[model samples]
Target: MDLLVVGGGPVGLVVALRAADAGLTVTVLEPRHGPVDKACGEGLMPAARERLAQVGAAPNGHDLASIVYTDGRHRVSAPLTRPGLGVRRTVLHAALLEAADRAGVQVRHTRMIGIEPGDPRDHARPARVRTSDGQERTAPFVVAADGLHSPTRRALGLERPARLPRRFGLRAHYAVAPWSDAVEVHWSRNAEAYVTPVADDLVGVALLCRPPGRWDPTWRSFPELAWRLAGSEQTSAVRGAGPLRQRVRSMVRGRVLLVGDAAGYVDALTGEGLTLGTAQAFAAVDAVLAGSPAQYARRAPALGRRSTLLTRGLLAVSGQPAIRRLIVPAAARVPAVYRGAVHQLAGGH
Candidate 1:
């Protein structure tokens, strides 16, 4: 095959579809079947929606007009100049899978357990991958989109140690109508609860926080949100993912490249994870088609530079109680700056 994309998630499928469109044969390896779901904020920025549409993977979702941050006492909202989307992870995955099928991209129900880099002396040599079935496959270029805790990245020894306090994400869906058209982020002393409307009668709530010794029940942290959801039926079991920060040594090594969360991840504080990952997928395909895999390493980081900077800045403040408490108030006090920040978060100039 021309390309082997590890992980059949949205970003991986995106790589497959794009490569196939360019007349390159592509295959995707994912142990899980279609409609794979994950614990995510479920809010796609306006730019992300457009990118998915361009690739023919747009899915049905609730429209989001703005972002509102509240600490109960203080609240501020920034309108997205363009509308965003609140899509369930499963729904988004299904859309991407359908597009991949239409593009004639092969989907294999196998896991990639290991990778053997192609000859360093010959850039044209195909890289070999060992699947969980104990079979080996070769492809001219390999993309490791195997998520945050990527086995491919670990096997390659590219994992970097994280120095900050570990934080986790927990998500669940509630069977209740959305009260607002905006994505609401409710802040507490210990954690932040993200409420996004994914359907006419379903909203997803995701929590970003440190391990729960500082707060118990977790729901207690967001009193207002808990009250609002008190009588609502839970639509899905809670899903969690953590130590949110992932650092990587490099994105390129010979004919192999890492995209999406496998490349690196900061915090999802700003809800731009999908947008950033999509940008990496675009850069990866361009580099591969250009016959310059090394260019991806140079281009990937710049693609998410703006989002990373803002997310890191917010994460730092989130760790400091006094500063964190000032966030909503500050944003409220300076509407222009807050709006500019929101515009930048949406991939605007």
Candidate 2:
């Protein structure tokens, strides 16, 4: 194969599609079935939506026009420079799978158990991988988009220890009608509730918190949200992911390039995961096409620097209860700053 993309999630599929569009044969390795779902704030920022369309994986969902920050008593709203989309993970995954099928990208239903990096100096040499079934595969270029806590990243010795306080995220869907065209982020003392409208009759609520014990995303924690969701039937089970941060030593090793969460991740506080992941996917293929996968290491960081800095800064301030109480008020007081940040997040930069 010309490219081996490990991890069949949206980002990995994107890498395959882009490479296939360039006339390179691509194979994706994934243990899970198609249309896989995960615990995530499923709101796609404007750039993410655009990139999905650009890559021929556009999925239908509710239109998202803005972000609203609230602390019950205080609220601040910022409009996205371009409208975004609030899509369910499975919906997004299915679209990508279809797009990959149309592009002739083959997907293997197995996990990568081992890898041997190719000679970085010889672009023609193939990197090899051992699958769970004891089969071996080789490709000139490999992109790992295996997500947070990626085994591929660990095996490659790219994982970095995160020193900050650990945080977690829990997401569930509710069979409730759309409330607004905005993604609502409700602030509380211990956690934040991110409510996104994914369909006319479905909404996704994700809670990000520094858990005190077990991972319980208690809705009562946010009285306002609880009241709003009272008696609403849940459409899906609660799903969770965390420490919410993954640091990486670098994005490339020999012919292997890491994309998506496998590359590294910050908190999902800003809802930039898909946007950054797709950008990295494109860059990974570009580097591979240039016959130097190492260029991806230099290119990927710039794609996520702004998001990393902003998420870390927000997490730092919000970790302190005293300052956390001021976040919504601060945004309400300085609308322009909040608006500019939203614009940046929406890729207006």
Candidate 3:
């Protein structure tokens, strides 16, 4: 194959689809079948929505028109310049999988143990990967989209365990009519409740907190979020992910390119993972098509600069109780600042 993409998540499939559309042979390796689920906020920024359309993975989902920052008493909201999608992760994955198939990208069931850089003499040969069943495969190019806890990235010796105060996210679905078109972020002293309208009749609630058992209790820390979700029957089991941060040394080494969370990640405070991953996948594929894998290393991080800064800033504010108390109030005092940030985040530039 010209391109061998590891981890058939949305971003991985997107890489394969784009490469195949560009007339490159592509194959995706994933252990799971269709509609794989994960703990995600499930809100796509407008940029990610556009990329999904470009890749022909047009999945229908609830429309997100704005973002609301609130602390129950204080609230600030800004309309999106471009609309976004509040989609279930499984639903989005299924759509991307179908699109990958239509693009003639082969999907294989296997687990990648690790990646070994290809020989220096054969620049066209891809790094080798050992599978769970003791099978090895090599290709001209490889994009790792295996996610935050990626084994491929570990094997590449590009990761360092997070040393900062870490947090995790747990998500569950509630069967209820969406309260609003805006994604509501309910802030509290301990954790923040991310409420997203994933369907006409379903709202996905994801909690970002330091503690482990907080998710099972259902918004107990944030009374405002709890009240809104009160009496809404839970529709899905709780799923979780990460310390919410992964550090990487680089995006490219030899013929391998790290895309999506597999590349590196910051806190998910801004919900920009999907957007950044989609952009990186496209960038990686473009470099592969140009026969210059090193180009992706320079381009991928630039794409995430805005997102990283915003997320780190927000995480810092949220970590400080005094500053957290002022966030929504300050935003409300100056609506344009909030609006401008929202517009920029919605891909208005």
Per-residue lDDT of candidate 3, residues 46-119 (tens digit): 99999999889989899999999998888999988788999999899999988987888899898998788674
lDDT of 1 by residue, 1-349 (tens): 8899999999998888888888899999999976988999999999888889878888999999999989888888999888899999999999999998899999999998889868544856678899998899998889889999999889888999986787889899999999998899999888888999999999999988888623233377788887888888888988899788999999988788999889988887888888888888888999889877878888888988888898888888879988988988998899888888888888775
lDDT tens digits, residues 1-349, model 2?
Answer: 7899999999999899999999899999999986998999999998888888887888989999999999999999999888899999999999999999998899999999999878879856679899997899998888999999898899999988997688888899999998899999998887888999999999999988876624343466678888888888987998989888899898888888999999888888988899899899999999999988768878889998887889889999998899999999999999999998888877775
lDDT of 2: 0.89
Q: What is the TM-score of each candidate against the true structure?
A: 0.96, 0.97, 0.96
Measured by TM-score, the strongest candidate is 2
Clashing pairs in 3: none
Candidate 2 positional error at 241, Å? 0.8
* Residue 317 displacement (Å), model 2: 0.9
Among these predictions, the greatest lDDT belongs to 2
Worst 10 residues of 1 by lDDT: 212-221
The residue ranges of model 2 lying beyond 4 angstroms of the native Cα positions read 213-218
> Each candidate's lDDT (Cα)?
0.88, 0.89, 0.87
